[model samples]
Target: MLRAIIVDDEELSVKRLKRLLSESKDIETCHTFMNPLEAYEYAKSSPVDVAFLDISMPELDGMALSGLLLDLDNAMDIVFVTGHDEYALQAFDASALDYLLKPVTAERLDKTLAKIRKNRGYTAAEPALSVFLFNGLRLCRSRKGQETIRLRSPKTEELFAFLMFRRAISREEIVDTLWSDLETDKALKNLNSTLYYIRKAIGSGQTGDCIEAGRHEIRIAESSLYCDLYEFERLLKQIRSAPEPSADLFKRAEVLYTGEFLKGKSYEWASEQTRRLEQDYIELLEAAARFHIGIHQPQQSLRYFCEILKLDAIREDISHEVIRLYTELGRKHEAFQQYRLLEQSLQQELGTRPDPRVEDFIMKLMR
Candidate 1:
């Protein structure tokens, strides 16, 4: 049996390899990485038997990651899997375990993977994962804490990440997200200006056609670095499928929050994505609370529910649950006060009454 991680910037390639590897009973797909830098980081933190990799990526390339990964784990060998044949020699020169061209044949991949298994007794070290834009009405969101060129809200940052995310965003969609109401000429000028700004912020020409901004579509540079949101989503899936109560729960919750999901922007809130993220945020809070509860820690549940309240005040169910916990812990007056506060907020915000269940609970409490 072989444990493997596929490192490819191409989704199709990743999908194919995953399908092929899944058919093999002796393989466990450890983790698939889209960026060399991330692969390098994870390689340091996780164990990987074979790295089916590509040569070019943002932040780092296959060659660079291969070299760095080798240093991190001298016994870890790289099996370069890519479209270009020219890099084969460089792959071998880097002392990579092997170089297998893309559109990978089962036989070749098996050979490469088998070679990796044959050398599995080795250990390696590795280390450790953006943006929104709206048109002439270019709305940029900067991270609340850092000014990382990647995290910053440059036009290019928005363009780059957007392309990476949607795999392509249309120029019209870009304009729509940024300046849906503007004239075509004005929109184009603004888009170009924003791109220039992005280029300046990240480095000249970094987000070129790789982030295709053509008449009908815009897409990330197929060869650029990976998006944080994508990786964040990937971790979310991992945590969901393998539900645990420790670091993964919190880490996944943190990533899904992503600082309010493109904060500081007011463009197209009605889009499916905007609605979806809002739902995910609420779900993550609930997930966090559930995990905490399962771990025999009611306080953790209490705190997560508080976070949920910050986003949503209508969840009288959670509010009441927390209040009951507080009361059961011998804080009766505190819980009663919580009911009063919620009643006041509901009246002030919705001009309505608490749900019947809550009203009954409060009535019972008052007695």
Candidate 2:
């Protein structure tokens, strides 16, 4: 029983491959991603025995995406599924185990599976513990399914989240940060109560030892946690330090930020971080847009521009860029429509219309 992921930009291709893969008894589960970036993100936290990737994909090609996946788990097999045969040589050079041409036959896929099994002996899937902090804090403890634990109280939940955020903090610091409004004795008492509640909530299991408390300090046992937030931050740092950051890396990080960090909660300490993460997400979108523009892929860049507007709708500058992209892509009507929406947004929200420059830009494009 092996887990596999199918990545292809084409919707029909992805569906077809997924259907075919599902027929195989060797495959326990088959996840499909039309977005290469999403496939890369899924592979990061999940254990995949083999990845069936399309050789040619927008944003990130199959070869480059496969390399990144291999970096995560070098033991995993890479199988390139494409309509082209020219890339077969290059695919092997990248250490791909097999290359299957498009409209893949069942017989061919079976052969690839056999090769993978021969290369890496089949083993039972292992249970994994994962913490997702994008839209909210959710715990998943196994490949079988996700586990969403309910805390005893809001304060207990906050206390657990606080520890996850700080990784490790002195008892004094924890009390000061989370319970500063209370009397010193009361604050310490509250902290103790909350810690007990948190322990009760997570209970004894794979995640039982995730939180460790000492006499003077408490910490998250990172080895016991596979946190999305940690991975997102790590990708951001890696991209910033890299001489030539990969757009796929940016997209992977961008996908992790499904919403504001710890959203729907009012943790005073977390507000600033939420804003910072959103800004980081916007910047990644900007970088991806810029990359598409550099490659003369206005359609791709336009998609990113629209996404930016979704996050920061009031950015007249971004709106202007989007209008320009719409115009360049021969979508004058959409360009006008975009302007009207921005116009309405500004007037209704900020008591103004689109900037005069934006109006002029659209008018020129219309002519």
Candidate 3:
């Protein structure tokens, strides 16, 4: 087993990472520390195959600690764990092997471990391509949790997204969806060229029969890809199928919705899917809000309520809920400000006022 060490200022973060690493048989936890100085001293005496370091630690950060660790053992692999995306380039600049975002998924961590194995001359499994459809279309091929390649092309990206949702479709149907405005013959030619580029962009040989085209229909082979949209849908299906929805299931669903589906994309075919995912996201947030409320966790409930309000500011019920939470938490000024903002937003956007229920609640609270 590959011996590994973890260092994070947050105790919970360290525990979470250790739990995740425990699931991987290929890795063994050698040591864990919440103090960077102690970790530094330990590293000097103990040799480890890999070190997972948190970037934002007090006094000594991951980047600086990495330099010190490398000075001890130049062959050691360092993986930076961070909550911020801004530190990605810097993490790589420090000659780190990989970086994982907060709330790291097991699937993602497996890929990171595979990378470390590959560097050590062990044969590693092929890493899956992670497709993020929420914020534009980003295709990432990763090994050991570090992005090896990112594929980008507007029309090809759109075609990939369209195909991912449908799985299989006739070339004629694709032509109609993406290129209906163009002449039939021209559209067919564009479709052919776009398919060629898509396969090339995604690595036909490496990805292996991921996109297959036959005499009439083109389909994406589902087994070869991992998509956020597909994963989100799967989680929703699981929750619906479960006899009793657990807190873990709802939290899992919440994490899948990193952002709005296909945000900033304006394909006619995508509009419906976009709206459906948005509605699902809002409902998930609402359910989480209720779940937290049921458990008497007002802070958590208010967080979900605020997220929902961000999507639909005029949601009177959610606004009322936020106000109530603020009042309960003794944040009276914030509660009053929230009410005023809602009142102003309604008058400006819809030429209306807060609902009578909201008005009454505000009056009672203000008194």
Clashes of each: 16, 0, 3
Residue-level lDDT of model 1, residues 65-179, one tens digit each, is: 7777778777666788888898877888888888887776554555666666667753221111023321111222233323444434555545544545477666777777766
**Residue 260 in model 3: shift from native, Å?**
2.3
In candidate 3, list every pair of residues with a backbone clash: 111-144, 112-144, 112-145
Candidate 2 accuracy as TM-score: 0.63
Q: State, as a TM-score between 0 and 1, how close model 1 is to the true structure.
A: 0.54
> Once superposed on the true structure, which residue ranges of model 3 sit more than 4 Å away at CA?
1-127, 143-145, 148-152
State the RMSD for candidate 3: 14.4
User: How does candidate 1 score on lDDT?
Assistant: 0.64
**Models, CA RMSD each:** 13.2, 13.2, 14.4
* CA lDDT of each prediction against the hidden true structure: 0.64, 0.82, 0.83
Across 1-367, the per-residue lDDT of candidate 2 in tens digits comes to 6899999988888887786676555688899998999998898889999899998998899999999999999988899999989998999999999999877765566678889877887543343566677788776666334666777888887888888888999999998999888988999999988898777767755466888888999988765657778878877765664445656777778778878789887899998888888898888888888888888988888888899999878899888889898878788899899898898889888998878889888778767
lDDT of 3: 0.83
- Which residue window of length 10 is worst by lDDT in model 2? 122-131
Candidate 2 residue pairs in backbone clash? none
